[model samples]
Target: MKTRSKIEEEYWEALERLKSGTTKSVDTKSTRFKFTKDAVGREAGRGKGYVRYERYPLLCEAIADAEEARKKNGPATPTANAKLEQQKALKQKAIGDYNQLKQEYDLLMTEYLNVVRRNFELETGLAETKDVKIIRIPNVR
Candidate 1:
């Protein structure tokens, strides 16, 4: 088992390596940190020849912190900007299509209402006129 102080020191070292881009991944075989079992027993003053399972969680936490810091400090690249512009254009096109469909729907609805009104007048025997006039109907049984 590694001492608490030694584990903390290794954590910091791993974090520094992550920030410096010396290692691309943490808590994996690809990790270049000397705290792993792979680094143990290889060379003197390198590291203990065993995996420190207890320190794994701390190492993972440090890696996550470094990644977050990098994200905040990183600038938006050109590719990211281009993707954003593309998304905006697609949204505009969809809005335009929806508006066109709405206009067509409104026109069709108006025409349908006019047809229904004309049919109702014909069935009721009502004539459109400026003045009212009485019409006599023949009684048929």
Candidate 2:
């Protein structure tokens, strides 16, 4: 088993490297940073406010492994088994992350549309305000 302290230390180190700006090797992808206002103040904004790097992929793979383990173990396996339960929990977390990203992407798209619509409205001197509203409804299971 990996030491949690070591894991946490590494996590913080990686975060610090990120915070301090790590060197990007030639192979690394170049991404743009945007400036945006927050409740506190303006801070650097990720294009879509998404973390799309090593940790994201690792989390995704862990979730997949968990799912596979769950399927392989089947209903006969005790659901309370620590490993299986942990895997299930991780899978749920990944799903939640995916859902959250989807929602955020949808919202950004809507915001982009509104901005474009308003730009066109201004250019054409149109008084139509119908297309500026954003409506979000949650699905009930």
Candidate 3:
């Protein structure tokens, strides 16, 4: 068994490598140990050029490991199903919240785009107006 500090140190070194643009790959060892970019980054010191999970094998292994763990531990006992069901319910609730936030974000983005477009149109119209005059108002004490 690896000590907590050792594992953390490995992860941190790997992340530092990544941040320095030296680390190239995300390796899930044949031993089934998976390391994700976010996981690595969370364990890592912060800085730019932090080559994260972006365009990389990030979620694939950790998710697979979680699924495997879930499958392996699933429901041998009669009460296990109940616990599993509760876990599923919680996961579903989290998914629901994520979807709700996504929808709200999409709506907000659309609204913002419309506002920007309107502002752009207004500005263009104002710019094109021949009768518009610019007058500097002097500050009066």
Which scores better on TM-score, 1 or 3?
A: 3
* lDDT, candidates in the order shown: 0.58, 0.47, 0.58
Error of 3 at 74 (Å): 25
For candidate 2, write residues 28-118 as lDDT tens digits: 1223321111100111122232433353545334434544654564455345687788898999999999999999999999999999999
What TM-score does prediction 3 earn?
Answer: 0.37
State in Å the error of residue 76, model 1: 16
lDDT of 1 by residue, 57-95 (tens): 655555456556655776544588898998999999999
Using TM-score, rank the candidates from best to worst: 3, 1, 2
Per-residue lDDT, model 2, residue 36, is 15
Tens-place lDDT per residue, model 3, 34-129, is 344454544454333343344233333543465466457544444788989989999999999999999999999999999999988987788788
Which 10 residues in a row give candidate 2 its minimum summed lDDT?
Answer: 34-43
Q: TM-scores of the models, in the given order?
A: 0.34, 0.31, 0.37
Q: What is the Cα-based lDDT of residue 59 in candidate 1? A: 55
Off by over 4 Å in 1: 1-78, 126-141
Q: Extract clashing residue pairs from model 1.
A: 40-48, 40-49
- Give the CA lDDT, 0 to 100, for residue 124 in model 1: 61
